[model samples]
Target: MLVAVVLAVAATVGVVLFTRVATRPEPAARPTAPPPATAKVVRTDLVDRVEVDGTPGYGAATPLSGRKQGTLTWLPEPGKVVDRGQPLYAVDAVAVPLLIGSTPLYREIRADVPAGPDVRVLQENLVALGYAEAGPPDGKFDAGTGRALRKWQKAAGLPQSGVLAQGDALVLPAAVRVDRVTAQLGAAAEGELMEVTGTERLVTAELEKSRRDYAPAGAAVEVRLPDRRTAAGTVRSVATASAEEGETKLVVTVAFADPAAAPESGQVVVVLTGARRDQVLAVPVRALVALAEGGYAVEVLRDGGRSLVPVEPGMFASGLVEVTGPGLVEGAEVVVAS
Candidate 1:
């Protein structure tokens, strides 16, 4: 009976404890709030002026024999640095058969001779090839003109022909040469015969017309040569029309402002494009949270608080993108702590 009384008392105590534990109230869960606006980051970009590849070309053109493409003569014997007015070719005076009638300039051919613009073009091209001797190519073959022609012919080993043959060559424009046969030995040439060139810039590059706008004038540009040498030059000229290749091109001509040596012609090179930003709004791309509702939003922090605002994105250059949307006014102290 005593043991039974003790066991009963223990059982009553256990029951009282269990009831007390079960009656205690449970701790409440902490509430969760929406993420603050300032927590999110929006990327931004700005419109910028950029540069494209362009090449320095002869501001002028030099004419060559149009007779088909004769057996590629001497190809400007490699390594000859002929100077301005330097003789490049000397054709034998033998009466080469002319498919096209040969008429001396004295009669000057009764055909509609180019008077003003056409002559201007000739003079300009002649000056470019070092044949016109730097003065305004007056289109009149005066003594100075004869002197230049004779100088070139003499150098070319042609007879001291004071007479400027209608198809005689003036200079070799390009530095490369290839073997090509274009006319019948006894046939004739109805086009330009002699070719010539102008001064050499440290490097040369060609630009496609599509990228013309990007290659602004006075752009800081550089050219990498095969020897790993980089020559610097400014944009001297930009061709306004599409080249004969049928591709619109902006020939950005650059000459080494301070070149150790003139860049060799006919070398392949890689051109680089660069960009800069002036004054514009930029935003983080990731900070742009697309709320399922509509429009885009960015987080902003003020006095330890956050706010959300929508924005309209604009042109992007490099890493930054331009934006002008809700909460994005010019000079509106936006934070880009990152």
Candidate 2:
């Protein structure tokens, strides 16, 4: 009986040992995927751009009125480029030339005229035309002014009366391209005479008021032309007045650096580039992982092990996002989810 009992105890022990061996788990397999494809952190330049639809055409249309009323004998054709000394239109067979000045000719300009801004305008033009041989530009129209006026009149085939009528010349701030002529050859030169715009082509866009901060005067921009060509442009003007609709909107005008490269009139894309950073640390946007708490983080691979690193995300361009964090350096491997 003792022998039998000892044999039974040995059998029970053997069965327990066999069950433990069968239930034991195997060693974990080594990962073969290399911790999900990884990308290297790089230091490069980044530019954030906001693209908006824009119209490519003349900058702004300015109305040109006839200074004097008379029969329109001649008018510049639409699309004609009028320079400083060129005739913008003719009244009663008399050509009214264009002069560059901000001050309009409110009254007749002639010798013995009192010193005023208008007098200065005439004097400046006279000096520029080599007609004023007496002295520098001055507001007073003296005897030298008379000689210059008569010389200019003679050259322009006008009566050498040394007197400038209020409508004798069309004054503009700068040279312009004739956009439209309102009056016909035989029509009366009265009221609105024509329309003009800057010589260079520009792109105009209406930006939402909320996004007004995105575009400011002098901001650099990129224009994509109809031919798929890209051109550099600058924000020339931003209208303070907002158009009232469901949402307020502001007008933004961008002038192309190379006007000749711009299409005459068509729809284009205007990309407003924001602040740029050079030699900044950046990584693939996919590598970024949102932390459960609040900010963002990235999985950094170091010494065959991955560590969750907190990062401050910044401007994003292309597929890369700017990031800054502790121990984040160029050429650092970052794990990205497949």
Best prediction by lDDT: 2
Question: lDDT values of the candidates?
Answer: 0.49, 0.86
Worst 10 residues of 2 by lDDT: 240-249
Q: Per-candidate TM vs. native?
A: 0.49, 0.76
lDDT for each residue of candidate 1 in 1-338, tens digit (9 for 90 to 100): 99999999999999999999999899988899654332223333344534343333333344545422233233244234444334343233322211111222222211244333333333444456567562475555455655665565565455566653344433232342212223333334444434334445434456666676545666666666556676665655565556785866555656566755454454534354444445656665655657788876665565576566677665566555666665665444344434
Assess candidate 2 and give its lDDT.
0.86
Regions of candidate 2 where Cα sits further than 4 Å from its true position: 1-35, 52-56, 185-188, 203-214, 222-232, 240-251, 256-270
What value of lDDT does candidate 1 attain over all alpha carbons? Answer: 0.49
What TM-score does structure 1 among the candidates reach? 0.49
Candidates' RMSD to native: 8.8, 7.3
Q: How high is the lDDT of residue 63 in model 2?
A: 89
